[model samples]
Target: MTAVKVIKVVGTSEESWEAAAKEAVERASQSVEGVHGVEIDHWTAEIEDDEIVEYRATTEIAFPVQD
Candidate 1:
Protein backbone atom coordinates (compact mmCIF):
# COMPACT_ATOMS: atom_id res chain seq x y z
CA MET A 1 0.00 0.00 0.00
CA THR A 2 1.04 3.55 -0.67
CA ALA A 3 0.12 6.75 1.04
CA VAL A 4 0.71 10.41 0.45
CA LYS A 5 0.92 13.55 2.56
CA VAL A 6 0.15 17.16 1.86
CA ILE A 7 1.43 20.20 3.70
CA LYS A 8 1.15 23.91 3.37
CA VAL A 9 4.22 26.08 3.08
CA VAL A 10 4.70 29.75 2.41
CA GLY A 11 7.59 31.06 0.36
CA THR A 12 8.80 34.58 -0.18
CA SER A 13 11.10 36.13 -2.71
CA GLU A 14 12.13 39.52 -3.96
CA GLU A 15 11.28 38.38 -7.45
CA SER A 16 7.96 37.04 -8.73
CA TRP A 17 5.24 34.79 -7.38
CA GLU A 18 6.47 31.97 -9.57
CA ALA A 19 9.87 32.14 -7.92
CA ALA A 20 8.29 32.07 -4.50
CA ALA A 21 6.24 29.03 -5.36
CA LYS A 22 9.26 27.23 -6.72
CA GLU A 23 11.22 28.09 -3.59
CA ALA A 24 8.56 26.46 -1.44
CA VAL A 25 8.81 23.19 -3.29
CA GLU A 26 12.55 23.24 -3.35
CA ARG A 27 12.87 24.01 0.32
CA ALA A 28 10.41 21.27 1.23
CA SER A 29 12.36 18.77 -0.80
CA GLN A 30 15.49 19.60 1.14
CA SER A 31 13.88 18.40 4.35
CA VAL A 32 11.30 15.90 3.10
CA GLU A 33 12.22 13.32 0.56
CA GLY A 34 10.16 12.14 -2.38
CA VAL A 35 8.67 15.54 -3.01
CA HIS A 36 6.38 15.10 -5.96
CA GLY A 37 4.47 18.25 -6.75
CA VAL A 38 3.30 21.66 -5.64
CA GLU A 39 0.04 23.55 -6.00
CA ILE A 40 -0.02 27.31 -5.58
CA ASP A 41 -2.97 28.46 -3.52
CA HIS A 42 -2.58 32.22 -3.60
CA TRP A 43 -0.18 35.10 -4.13
CA THR A 44 0.59 38.22 -2.18
CA ALA A 45 3.06 41.03 -2.27
CA GLU A 46 4.68 43.44 0.15
CA ILE A 47 4.67 47.09 -0.75
CA GLU A 48 7.15 49.71 0.33
CA ASP A 49 7.08 53.29 -0.72
CA ASP A 50 4.30 52.38 -3.14
CA GLU A 51 6.57 49.84 -4.77
CA ILE A 52 6.40 46.08 -4.69
CA VAL A 53 9.20 44.91 -2.45
CA GLU A 54 8.56 41.22 -2.15
CA TYR A 55 6.41 38.48 -3.56
CA ARG A 56 4.83 35.72 -1.53
CA ALA A 57 3.18 32.48 -2.46
CA THR A 58 1.10 30.04 -0.51
CA THR A 59 1.63 26.52 -1.75
CA GLU A 60 0.61 22.98 -1.02
CA ILE A 61 3.38 20.42 -1.23
CA ALA A 62 2.78 16.76 -1.88
CA PHE A 63 5.05 13.82 -1.10
CA PRO A 64 4.85 10.11 -0.63
CA VAL A 65 5.05 8.63 2.80
CA GLN A 66 8.09 6.56 3.53
CA ASP A 67 8.08 3.31 5.40
Candidate 2:
Protein backbone atom coordinates (compact mmCIF):
# COMPACT_ATOMS: atom_id res chain seq x y z
CA MET A 1 0.00 0.00 0.00
CA THR A 2 1.09 3.52 -0.72
CA ALA A 3 -0.07 6.88 0.53
CA VAL A 4 0.05 10.22 -1.19
CA LYS A 5 -0.32 13.80 -0.04
CA VAL A 6 -1.23 17.03 -1.74
CA ILE A 7 0.17 20.48 -1.10
CA LYS A 8 -0.67 23.85 -2.57
CA VAL A 9 2.12 26.19 -3.59
CA VAL A 10 2.26 29.57 -5.25
CA GLY A 11 5.07 30.80 -7.46
CA THR A 12 5.59 33.95 -9.44
CA SER A 13 7.47 34.82 -12.57
CA GLU A 14 7.79 37.69 -14.98
CA GLU A 15 8.26 35.21 -17.80
CA SER A 16 5.34 32.79 -17.93
CA TRP A 17 2.96 30.68 -15.95
CA GLU A 18 4.80 27.52 -16.90
CA ALA A 19 7.98 28.93 -15.44
CA ALA A 20 6.14 29.89 -12.29
CA ALA A 21 4.78 26.38 -11.89
CA LYS A 22 8.18 24.88 -12.53
CA GLU A 23 9.67 27.22 -9.97
CA ALA A 24 7.18 26.08 -7.37
CA VAL A 25 7.97 22.44 -8.02
CA GLU A 26 11.70 22.97 -8.01
CA ARG A 27 11.61 24.97 -4.80
CA ALA A 28 9.49 22.33 -3.15
CA SER A 29 11.72 19.54 -4.38
CA GLN A 30 14.67 21.19 -2.68
CA SER A 31 13.32 20.19 0.74
CA VAL A 32 10.90 17.49 -0.34
CA GLU A 33 11.41 14.12 -1.96
CA GLY A 34 9.39 11.49 -3.81
CA VAL A 35 7.45 13.96 -5.84
CA HIS A 36 4.87 12.24 -7.99
CA GLY A 37 3.22 15.03 -9.95
CA VAL A 38 2.16 18.64 -10.10
CA GLU A 39 -1.21 19.96 -11.15
CA ILE A 40 -1.80 23.59 -12.04
CA ASP A 41 -4.83 24.71 -10.10
CA HIS A 42 -5.23 28.37 -10.97
CA TRP A 43 -3.44 31.39 -12.42
CA THR A 44 -3.53 35.08 -11.69
CA ALA A 45 -1.57 38.15 -12.55
CA GLU A 46 -0.63 41.45 -11.08
CA ILE A 47 -1.38 44.51 -13.11
CA GLU A 48 0.48 47.76 -12.85
CA ASP A 49 -0.58 50.80 -14.84
CA ASP A 50 -2.90 48.66 -16.95
CA GLU A 51 -0.05 46.34 -17.84
CA ILE A 52 0.72 42.88 -16.59
CA VAL A 53 3.54 43.12 -14.08
CA GLU A 54 3.92 39.58 -12.95
CA TYR A 55 2.28 36.21 -13.35
CA ARG A 56 1.39 34.01 -10.43
CA ALA A 57 0.61 30.33 -10.56
CA THR A 58 -1.03 28.12 -8.02
CA THR A 59 -0.30 24.42 -8.19
CA GLU A 60 -1.21 21.29 -6.37
CA ILE A 61 1.79 19.02 -5.82
CA ALA A 62 1.30 15.35 -5.13
CA PHE A 63 3.98 13.25 -3.52
CA PRO A 64 4.40 9.98 -1.68
CA VAL A 65 4.24 10.13 2.08
CA GLN A 66 7.54 9.38 3.71
CA ASP A 67 7.66 6.77 6.40
Candidate 3:
Protein backbone atom coordinates (compact mmCIF):
# COMPACT_ATOMS: atom_id res chain seq x y z
CA MET A 1 0.00 0.00 0.00
CA THR A 2 1.06 3.56 -0.59
CA ALA A 3 0.44 6.63 1.47
CA VAL A 4 -0.12 10.17 0.39
CA LYS A 5 0.20 13.39 2.31
CA VAL A 6 -1.19 16.83 1.87
CA ILE A 7 0.41 19.99 3.09
CA LYS A 8 -0.70 23.56 3.04
CA VAL A 9 1.63 26.28 1.84
CA VAL A 10 1.31 29.96 1.29
CA GLY A 11 3.28 32.03 -1.20
CA THR A 12 3.20 35.64 -2.22
CA SER A 13 3.93 37.48 -5.45
CA GLU A 14 3.51 40.98 -6.72
CA GLU A 15 2.48 39.83 -10.14
CA SER A 16 -0.65 37.70 -9.76
CA TRP A 17 -2.36 34.92 -7.82
CA GLU A 18 -1.34 32.32 -10.35
CA ALA A 19 2.32 33.16 -9.87
CA ALA A 20 1.91 32.99 -6.15
CA ALA A 21 0.30 29.57 -6.33
CA LYS A 22 3.02 28.31 -8.62
CA GLU A 23 5.68 29.63 -6.32
CA ALA A 24 4.21 27.79 -3.38
CA VAL A 25 4.16 24.51 -5.27
CA GLU A 26 7.71 24.97 -6.56
CA ARG A 27 9.10 25.80 -3.17
CA ALA A 28 7.36 22.85 -1.58
CA SER A 29 8.65 20.55 -4.29
CA GLN A 30 12.21 21.43 -3.36
CA SER A 31 11.92 19.61 -0.05
CA VAL A 32 9.15 17.24 -1.00
CA GLU A 33 9.65 14.38 -3.39
CA GLY A 34 7.15 12.69 -5.64
CA VAL A 35 4.87 15.65 -5.84
CA HIS A 36 1.56 14.59 -7.31
CA GLY A 37 -0.57 17.71 -7.60
CA VAL A 38 -1.58 21.00 -6.07
CA GLU A 39 -4.98 22.35 -5.08
CA ILE A 40 -5.70 25.99 -4.46
CA ASP A 41 -7.35 26.00 -1.06
CA HIS A 42 -7.79 29.72 -0.67
CA TRP A 43 -6.36 33.03 -1.84
CA THR A 44 -6.03 36.57 -0.59
CA ALA A 45 -4.14 39.73 -1.38
CA GLU A 46 -2.58 42.62 0.40
CA ILE A 47 -3.21 46.19 -0.62
CA GLU A 48 -1.75 49.44 0.50
CA ASP A 49 -2.96 52.96 -0.22
CA ASP A 50 -5.64 51.54 -2.52
CA GLU A 51 -2.98 49.76 -4.55
CA ILE A 52 -2.31 46.07 -4.77
CA VAL A 53 0.94 45.39 -2.97
CA GLU A 54 1.16 41.63 -2.92
CA TYR A 55 -0.78 38.61 -4.01
CA ARG A 56 -0.93 35.70 -1.60
CA ALA A 57 -2.11 32.21 -2.35
CA THR A 58 -2.82 29.21 -0.18
CA THR A 59 -2.42 25.81 -1.75
CA GLU A 60 -2.63 22.20 -0.73
CA ILE A 61 0.28 20.24 -2.14
CA ALA A 62 -0.03 16.51 -2.41
CA PHE A 63 2.87 14.09 -2.53
CA PRO A 64 3.71 10.50 -1.90
CA VAL A 65 4.76 9.70 1.58
CA GLN A 66 8.43 9.09 2.14
CA ASP A 67 9.61 5.99 3.88
Output the worst ten-in-a-row residue range by lDDT, candidate 1: 21-30
TM-score of 2: 0.94
Q: What overall lDDT, based on C-alpha atoms, would model 1 receive against the true structure? A: 0.93
What is candidate 1's lDDT per residue for 1-67, written digit by digit as tens?
Answer: 7799999999999989999998999899889999988889999999999998999999999999989
lDDT of 2 by residue, 1-67 (tens): 9899999999899998888998899988887898879999999999999988899999999989989
Per-candidate TM-scores read: 0.93, 0.94, 0.94
By lDDT, the best candidate is 3
Better of 1 and 2 by lDDT: 1
Model 2 pairs whose backbones collide: none
Sort the predicted structures by lDDT, highest score first: 3, 1, 2
TM-score of 1: 0.93
1-67, model 3: which lDDT tens digit per residue? 9899999999899999999999999999899999889999998999999998999999999999889
Q: Ten residues in a row with the worst lDDT in model 2?
A: 27-36
True lDDT of residue 19, candidate 1? 92
Q: What is the C-alpha RMSD of each candidate to the true structure, in Å?
A: 0.9, 0.7, 0.8
- The candidate, 1 or 2, that scores higher on TM-score is 2
Sequence-dependent TM-score of model 3: 0.94
